[model samples]
Target: MAKGQTIKVEIKRQATPDAPSYTEKFEMPYRPGLNITSVLVEIAANPVNTEGKETSAITYDSNCLEEICGSCAMLINGKARMACSALVDRLLDETKSDTITLAPLSKFPVVRDLAVDRSVLFENLKKVQAWVPIDGTYDLGPGPKQAPQIQEERYPLSNCISCTICMEVCPQFNTQTNFVGAATIAQAKLFNMDPSGSVLKEERLRALSGDGGIQECGFAQNCVQACPKQLPLTEAISDMGRDVFIQKVKDFVSR
Candidate 1:
């Protein structure tokens, strides 16, 4: 790679939800320390394809311009990753080619270009009641104290940014199955361990035990590998799976 060398990016573009998808190749002048998001910004500044044809700026979601936002997730070189964290040099080296392929997550419905509707993850999170319940916003001073061990156990699960990369890589998260995926399951575990949050543990467990819940997980563990935050997803899933199973037995006996 030489100074001012161009980076070739092939983007799969969709005009709208009902429109046909097509590929567009863009050549961006290389700059040191360029990330995928920066490349997209450059392309947006100069909306011209490789053929010198004027084109519209690419549409994609981005905020914070950091991995913390979890808004810039897309398929880069066929891998689900955050565009903000994906460096151009590293990607070029990894592919061993001049061209990098960019596309929307296949599991999600594309709104336009690389932007996809990721509301499903929020819906799934809601299903598991992945939050601590509070009666009122009014100063509930000095809440319950938790053991150090409990905090240590639940801390990693709390790092989830809701990027949905776990869902995107999940084998069961598809049109055919209503599988809630690993992120939501991990969130349930995180809250269930909370002192106040544990008040709703049975409710959370019951939610996971229902249709399109924890039982639907195929245990492929693709989610654990793909999560940028390196959340203890498999451990959470495993623990939640056991709890869900035990809950089912308890429910059966009570019946």
Candidate 2:
């Protein structure tokens, strides 16, 4: 991890969603305070491969490069993580290698090079009704008061940036099943905890009770470790799992 050394980078690329995929080699001068995004930006500005041949600019999604938007999520050295937070120096130290590897999430459909379709998460959240219900956009007076303790509990869940690293590392979130993954479940728990949002609690719980539901979770707990936000994902999943079970039992008994 010395300064001004050349860091070799390998990027997985695809011209289009249906196009054949390829890998490109790049060389970036190791610099102080260099992040993965910086490496990508440099390649984008230069668009030259290791062979000194001109190449297309790398395609990827990014916004609020501070890890808030979660758009810079990618497989760094074969691990799901945020590229914006992945510093080249620290990465080299962690891996004991001068070469860095970048690839799109394996489970997702690659839109281009490092970009993938993550709208599935939105659809999952939609199924769980992961938002507070409101009648109109009209001025709704100050809503229900939340205890400091409750607020504290909810804060961590609220920090989830939808990076999908949890899903990427999840075994259940594969082609074999339609498991909604940890982000969706955590959001369901977050909204269900809200005073106003609790109105749809029963519906939300029911949504997760059937196929591709909470029962599908393998409880590997990878979500807890991979989440960039460090969300209480395991706790949320556990609480929601209990609630979903009780909800299903209630539905059965009432029938």
lDDT of 2 by residue, 25-79 (tens): 9997888889999999999899899999999889888889899998889999999
Candidate 2, residue 79: how far the Cα is off, in Å: 0.6
Q: Which pairs of residues collide in model 1? A: none
The local lDDT score (0 to 100) that residue 146 gets in candidate 2 is 96
Q: What is the overall TM-score of model 1 with all chains considered together?
A: 0.98
How accurate locally, in lDDT, is each candidate? 0.93, 0.92
Q: How do all models score by TM-score?
A: 0.98, 0.98
- Which structure among the candidates has the greatest lDDT? 1
What lDDT tens digits, residue by residue, belong to model 1 across residues 114-175?
99999999998898899999888999899889999999999999999889999999989999
Which residue pairs does candidate 2 place in steric collision?
Answer: none
Error of 2 at 67 (Å): 0.9
